[model samples]
Target: MPTDPRLTRLDENRVRVNNPHGIGATLFANKEVPVESGAVTELIEMLALQNTARQFAKAAPGSFDHDPEILRVAVTPDFHKARGIPVGTVLATRGYMVPQAIGNDINCGMRLHTTTLRPDDVTARIDDLETAFRHIFFEGGRDIPMTRGQRHAMFTGGLEKMLSETRRVGEGLWPLVRELGVADQLDRVERRGSLPAGRVFGLSDFMGEEGRLSRDGQIGSIGGGNHFVEIQRVEKVLDGTVAHAWGLKSGTVTVMVHTGSVGIGHLCGGHYRDVVRKLHPQQLKHPDNGIFILPEGDRHRAHAESFWDALHNAANFAYANRMFLAVMAAAGMRQVFGDHVGYDLVYDAPHNFMWKEQIDGEEAILHRKGATPARGFDAMAGTPFAYHGEPVLVPGSMGASSFVMVGQGNNESMASASHGAGRMLSRGESMRGFDDEFRKFMEQFRVVTPTDLRRADVRQRPDILNKKLEQIKQEAPFAYKGIGPVVNTLTEAGIARPVVELVPLMTIKG
Candidate 1:
């Protein structure tokens, strides 16, 4: 493929894309254009159009007066085309908040848990483990009962509220919270796994009775579209010092959870998108691109506050949701490995969210969609990760090698890194053809789902079986870019350095 004249190679791993519409963007990849050149093109186009709209909004004469500026834009190695904005894109802006930038799945993130059991220990009972995971994660085995007040607290205060009410909410996974000493593990979580929610919006139906504990379906669900719960074994340790500090050892087992707030996120994202669109100046023509900006100033103070409140509400739910999923996974593991197998949180962080940060000494909102925060030691100061820097969990596609990396804290990239290997092929493209390859790949790896294909009852239902098979094929490893190149890009660019590499033993897709 011919190189685009617009792209200028900044370094071995960084490419600078000059955007004519607004501020140019920095792309982090092994090559200039990256593997998904089409997605890169879309990213540039999206930035260009959004920037054009931003300029028009600023210049257009209207009662809606606010200053909005796009400070810096960075693209991670996993860049891929999405609805309005491309995945793996990060934008830093002043005086404006873009709801589409964060996307619908707010706080859709990664979680890593280091365990005492070894690979051999897990492989010995792989079948039994798969059965347990399917039951716990898919077959209604997860019994997370929460009261109206507990649910309200979770929406309002995140994991912090749950920690505070640990003594009172003693049912279902509540015991695991105390047994696993999750309170002590708060430091391991990003922002201590809590974001203050101004108010709970569009979640009254989910909250149960005040005194009784009730099961909420969304609490422990591993939502679709690349979300998974995997059991992995550490394949190698690159940075021994950091690996030791993070309790990662070769051949040891680990649990990786990838999900978010599910429906709750959609609710908040949709609500805010409409709110921002409605707030757009009545006199000026709305931008052709669906991207709408919410201004942050006295003119729209109430709306600005409402946007943050909604964002925080969804973010808080996501934090607690991931914790519950991790706990549920731990519960399943204990059924097979016994309670002796310890599960310690390595790190938990969001890839899709906005951060209130400083840009060149000015207050700015840093929006990261399908990107991970790679803050360095100084930035991570006062936390346990200060010495080693923030842990950047980059999971590869299904059945591929995942990596744990430490942030280099390069402010040029907005202190961010890629979230994963990224997609080389879209889901529709991946689902077609490659039938023989898909079968071979599945034969080599263990992927447990709600359906037991081996059972006669399931096998008899061809329609159901085919649908399940198609879902798995869409996320097959062939659909994604090579993990090796993506990880190398991070290290080469001084964005992040690998601490350890992990390979999956079993995967659970919902």
Candidate 2:
């Protein structure tokens, strides 16, 4: 049988893979399109640059081509012209998987928790809200000044110990929290919502020197990028029943916490990639490009174990990261509402992750790079949200509106959905192109900035793409494929369904 006549090409740095199967794959560059490499110039010349996937396949053709039943490949819009694989390409396979394919930042993601406040409430207390958030969420990252005895209890007793004396804002919040799935999450969450036990051995010692350990506790906290803890209102409820189920109503305000396992996760991911590189060279089926190899002995198993362990650690770090943010946010709300302000965890999940899930009842390692789990079944079988499909939160660019969506249990694309309005341009481009517009957009939000930092912050802060003004030109609200269209695509494709829509009142970027 003539192997599906494989043909490849490069357009600038973008590599295009063409096969009779109609599987046309393109891999992009993280940097801008290159100019004049000096000699050959043609459409085919550009195609010469294989994105990461092609490079991987080229490395170990025997390993990939030998398997017929399982491998599936996908390229997200983030794919750019590049020498290696683009950042967002996704690969799912049964029996074996690659850690680099999923990237080093496992479970690197965004969360958008909502509140019960209305738009009016946001404007009325905007000043107070901003003050509370600045002090509690951003600057309050250090230990909460626990007394010596309290410290002992936290170390010895764990979550229960800390919660017992936590300056919880009010009495009634716990029940509502239970309703939102926080307490239940504590049990069902990986490691019962705790940090991984030991130092990430796989990570390079250099990262250790860079302080990966110090940042572990900060994982549950928000970082820059459009990542934030925003207060939003249900500007529009596309589906009433779903919205109600999500605790979203037009007048109700909510909080959206967007973060992930921070430095620790990146360190873990990088370490695993190194493990793959080391093990690949020893595999029985060597890759064409020498970048990949198919291990025949315990090396394969070792590779798998290393990646899996790193993934678990990173995932737990992310979960703890979000939980801690919730603790801080809950504390601040108690300060103002005194009793009225409240929230229930709609859903806490990560977009960038990998898991061992069954595809057509066959075990497979599914990778969601810049994607979220949009399982169709009500409540993913092993999750707390099993009764309700896991809530999927898709945040828009900074000033743009965000989404509150739910997963449909189908295993399409390995039960995953888009992570966000996927970035069309790199952060570098946004900063260079949309400075003035950003200033205007942020002006509407009332975030007080220091004089020195204001200019520096505006010097092309790509993070502000969520703001309307900066978003206007490049990532303008119009630049991104509309959230409505994406949601519609998900529903049409049976990947996910929209539950509610959230518009930001104020946003904070790292």
Candidate 3:
């Protein structure tokens, strides 16, 4: 096994020690960067295939990737390099922020709903159910109508706005939010479904759009790339008590929705990328640069506030998107079996984006990309699902099994775990290699995409389906690492424990 020279094995779960300028360390309460410092370019030599587990621990404290705002950094077992940083990297920042840390997918997260229905509910009527799902997301079956004020409120106000929208437009939300009891369902949602967003400027212009007067133009849409809505069956309950309390029973059905802030997240990330880049004009000269930071200071106060506003707006929009998508999926199911059982919210949490939390007595800002905060049971005492710990959705690639685990609150993990089986192959690489693998997946699982029965014209043209499949080649199941091993690592690392294992029955994507 290859070992990382930069890190000291604090234990099996922890990778510590680093240079202030090289590979990073965990944030300390005192205002100081922990570990030794080193050179940045020396950190990268390039890899041929999947990244080794020690990639995050390879650099010293002051390595090329170091920043003053970054007090400490840790990588989960799913650690893999991203554009500027790496996925599964957890950074503890004191009075500083990095946009790359959160990436463009503002509030990219997962929402899992436990349904009163079971696998048998749709098994016999699989074709009808698939048709129904296709209609709601792609065909004319999408009936969600958002009023102007409700749209402004949602984008500017986050979940609070959604609450008001529910009152105005939530009457027909029966099979989705109504059956679950909206009040109770909303409580289990992260931060009750909203986070405070910085003020969204020119909100009025975006509101009165002809397509809208509500919901920043893309409310009921599912943007592409690693995003999906899948129907899964809980095949096994790993922790009986936790699964029971969370309404997850063996044979019970679920809808797992994963996506982000859509165009909003990209817009905010793009604006700040240039801003951060310009902040460190000197650093831009470095070959391995692009990473930048924003600290709490008078000089850059406005930039910080505006960035948060944009980031939060995108994040809230994402929360709304996932909620709305669930409604669409439920509507499709209802179309097939009139008056079927409804699904209740289990837990909703974001994997991407930056947030502040008090960890180990220090007010630390965590930039968690491709990581979920696994708050242990104690941190969730007052919450409804507190007994089971925070609900986490770890999705496998298309047509594969996804696992639902609960946070174990490993403070050393910075309260985070893998979002999914980290991508082993890049999109371009997968497009080149996944032909045979994709065929095998098609034979085994009920894979549904927009090119299916949703569009009559596309259905007629055999060529379109083939074209669409090629377009989505990047997300082929073989393109990612094994989901089983990733979950095993989390449990062994003491970051999270599995509650229920979910096997996908049907999947729909862009």
Clashing pairs in 1: none
Error of 3 at 93 (Å): 1.3
Which segments of candidate 2 are over 4 A away from where they belong?
A: 1-70, 75-88, 112-114, 141-181, 187-220, 282-297, 378-388, 446-481
Q: What is the TM-score of each candidate against the true structure?
A: 0.96, 0.70, 0.85
Per-residue alpha-carbon lDDT of candidate 1 for residues 8-102, written as tens digits (9 for 90 to 100): 77777778887776486888876633445577667766675456446645654332344567888999988888877889999988777889898
Clashes of each: 0, 51, 23
Evaluated at residue 448, the lDDT of candidate 1 is: 88
In terms of TM-score, the best-performing candidate is 1
Rank the models by TM-score, top first: 1, 3, 2
Judge candidate 1 against the unseen true structure and give its global Cα lDDT, from 0 to 1: 0.86
C-alpha lDDT score of every prediction, in listed order: 0.86, 0.52, 0.70
Better of 1 and 3 by TM-score: 1
Better of 2 and 3 by lDDT: 3
Q: After best superposition, candidate 2 residue 490: deviation in angstroms?
A: 1.7
lDDT of 2 by residue, 223-287 (tens): 64546666677877877877776567886777777677677667776676566566553333443
lDDT of 1 at 484: 88
For residue 231, model 3's alpha carbon misses the true position, in angstroms, by: 0.2
